[model samples]
Target chain A: MNGAEKIRVENLTKFFINGKTAVSALENVNLTVNDGEFLCVVGPSGCGKTTMLRILAGLEKPTSGRVHINAKAAGVPSTAVVFQGDSIFPWMRVVENVEYGLKLRGVPLKERRAVAMEHLKKMGLERFAYLYPYQLSGGMKQRVNVARAFACDPEILLMDEPFGALDEQNRLLLQQELLRIWEENCKTTVFITHSIDEALLLGDKILVMTAQPGKVKALLDVKIPRPRDIILIKSSPVFIELYKEIWDLLKEEVLKARNIK
Target chain B: MNTTEERLSQNRASLGKEFWLKTFSFLSPLFLLFLWEALAALKLVDVRLFSSPSRIFKTLIPLVLSGELIYHTLISTMRIALGFLAGAIPGVALGLSMGLFPSVRALLMPLVAVTFPIPKLAIMPLILIVFGLGESSKIFTIAIGVFYLVLINTMAGVLNIDPIYIDVAKSFKASRIQFYTTVAFPGALPMIFAGLKLGMGTALLLIVAAELSAAKAGVGWMIWRAYDMFDIERMFCSLIVLAFLGFVFSYLLDFLEKIVIPWKKR
Candidate 1:
């Protein structure tokens, strides 16, 4: 399991019909992420970055080609997704929402609660154990969202711009928190973000993607060491180089995305 | 513009408003009862036609001690419970199926439209003719009356469940049973309970009308028998029993709603 290729997408294409006209969303997109690797996918808005993430999570289907996990079909999933919004069930309290997957799996109540509480503690949300999603702050809700995916102990975690909605300070804090958890868990994770600094700060490899009819434009591997600190990494030359290179690759796509094409 | 102490005092006043609102609600009925009693004592109103609270209370003790009130109340309750079970369970199941499948809706809509407008109680005479003047006829009429109300509410509830929730459940590979039980049932419960509460009231009314035709038991029968004997006090006592039963029914449903949907609780 340690050396296995966690996910493989081969020649994937997606088409959308807006009224009577058809538009290609992604074309001939192929990629693979190895086990325990943290890959960040960056692309212009509507570039199918989120679509690709949804595909990996089994929330959407490609118009053509195949997605495979460990040489098996990926139409269903052995993955869990942390959506862009908090997406916590308002009807469920913090601990109950976190334990949802476990509940579905028929994990016994006492044990499931213990495991849910453990994840909540990791997310610094034990104090809000019994609080409903509506009662939590935006940052706290996202924390619960992340904790929910992790609590399920999924082999592959798909995150679609999980911090895109947060304020800068909170985003940075959560980014560091994400890095800390990812380092400890070492699960295969594919994260979607528009933030170059975020990709640099957290990703072992960054996938830069182009706008509409999305294709992998560039893949940059970060040679940074593990247990990286946010303050230290921001100050490092290596981090700055990777950030600039990715930004340089992304600038044109960003322009095209904003309709300066 | 106000100081902290003034703000605190204002907050206290607002809290007092909610407390007073509840107090007013509880006291309003008692006040109405007091006024009625006063009017009767002063001979401002005919006491025989509009029985005062004291007279009604005096009438209630003997009816209870004689065990006649309890017997009538039990018979009425049993009929309602049986009728509700007969109607609502199948009605909801059928409604949900229709709601989820467009084809079912298309096929069933014509029949439902044709029959839904027809007052179910209007068929009571036909039911009585076929089933005879027994408990079965009354129960059957009550069931038919309640069924359509539950069906429409359940169908609407199922159709109106937040689509995003269904999408979420599907994305997680929820089994069909899981989808219905977790998503459909709980999502539709508030509406289903809404239907049931209305159905209970309708069933009670229909029970009285059914009893008026010819029946020997139930609160409705008791009321009609007392009317025939010109026992106004007994009639008032039966009406009081009916009111109490309706109150209890509504309160029980509300309590269950709060328990099941604790999300509504503060």
Candidate 2:
């Protein structure tokens, strides 16, 4: 592990126990995420990438092995996750949703509201700060979710296919929006997605995982320059090459997952 | 231009039809009332059995002016309010705990299932024996009825909350109090309100049953008294008041639901 490592996973494994059956979700997954790194993990469905993210977020416990975060000397490092579905509280307004983390931490109401509003503005959602989550479109709700993760100002962000439910237009729009916010904040992030193009577009390094009982297949460095445009980045030669490379690795896993000829 | 004009006329005709349909819907009850009045005036039916609407109103007006109607209405309302609070508060608390804690659920669920199906009125004799044929018995009967309805509904509400919301709360590192107050409670609120509405209706039903069995006061007792005396008009008056009470209680709950859960509006 490098001195700059923010997160280190050592042979992490998880098995879901149901009645008399134990299903392996992940197997011997070892990885390190450097400080302020944007690491995207791409894989076929049932690859346990979400399970890995959940473990990192402390929402789930690995059946074996361990994950260590390089916490500051003061306390444990704070981490926030953006889940795949609409995880925003329907009862809370957009601003309240964004400020949820700070509120839970016992930050005073006024200060938290200010921080929430600031993040909302960054997402260009200042106008919708008072609106309820139900009033917003799916894309807007996801924006609120992203803004909330950013507002918490955690040491790391774990996003599990946050925009996976959106349309192609919304998916691209949010990808760009996420990049803009990430560029500004640059927190250590582990984003899990099934989209190879998305993995290349956002990740500093893309970790591809194998089919069921997921293990790291490859970690390819994205070498794409910063201040990337979502539309223009796709046309670049290196971007196509990276996409093809990841796709080539991912196709076998997809077929293997589906048991297709 | 001609087609546009034709479409406008068609829209206007449909609008006119809709207006009359709504107006007719409103007038339907009046039509029934007038028919009853006509039948009584023409001596086409037995006046003692099917009292005219005017006669019922006349009896009601006197009862109101003499404060008899108001007194009985207040008594019934007070019993319901007290009994509903007694039942609903504990029911919701227990239900929430039952939904959240496995041990509590294990302890209470079987009891709830066994007791919920038995009509509350069936246990009136037991309640009467325990509390005597007094105010306590009447109130207790209503409370028990409301309790089961609210408890089951509340438990279902809590259980029905999407697990994802709980996961989100956990990920955010919400404390126990915050988890319940901010996530679990609010997530279960719509269902809780649903439970409360059902419980309120049950409270209304059970109150009348309890009152009819033993009470000297209340609209239900008045109806029974009028029946014994063969004062059909007075009985109709009491029935009208009971209907009004049910309407007001349901309307109050609907109004409270709107205020408490503004997000449910649209």
Against the reference, the lDDT scores of all candidates come to: 0.85, 0.90
lDDT of 2 at A21: 96
- lDDT per residue for candidate 1 within A1-261, as digits (tens), equals 275788899999989889998888899998989988899999888898888888887778889998997734434247888888747776788999898777777779999999999999988899999988778889999999899889878878888899999998999889988888889979889999988888888888999999887999998898889899988989899988888888888898888878834
Question: Under the 3 Å rule for N, CA and C atoms, how many clashes does model 2 have?
Answer: 0
- Give the TM-score, chain B only, in order for the candidates: 0.89, 0.94
Query: Individual DockQ of the candidates?
Result: 0.31, 0.69
Model 1 chain A: which ten-residue window has the lowest total lDDT?
A: A69-78
Q: Model 2 misses residue B166 by how many Å?
A: 0.8
TM-score of each: 0.83, 0.96
TM match of model 1 to true structure: 0.83
Give one digit per residue, the lDDT tens place, for model 2 in A134-174.
78999999999998888888888999999999999999999
lDDT (Cα, tens digit) per residue for candidate 1, span B43-135: 998987887888889989988999989999999999887887788888888888887788998998789879989887688789989999887
lDDT for each residue of candidate 2 in B1-266, tens digit (9 for 90 to 100): 56988999999999999999999999999999999899999999888888898888888888999999999999999999999998999989998999888899999888888888998889999999999988999889988988887888788888888888988899988888888899878888888888888888898888778988878999888888998899998889888888898899999989998888877744
| True-structure lDDT of candidate 1 | 0.85
Docking class of 1: acceptable
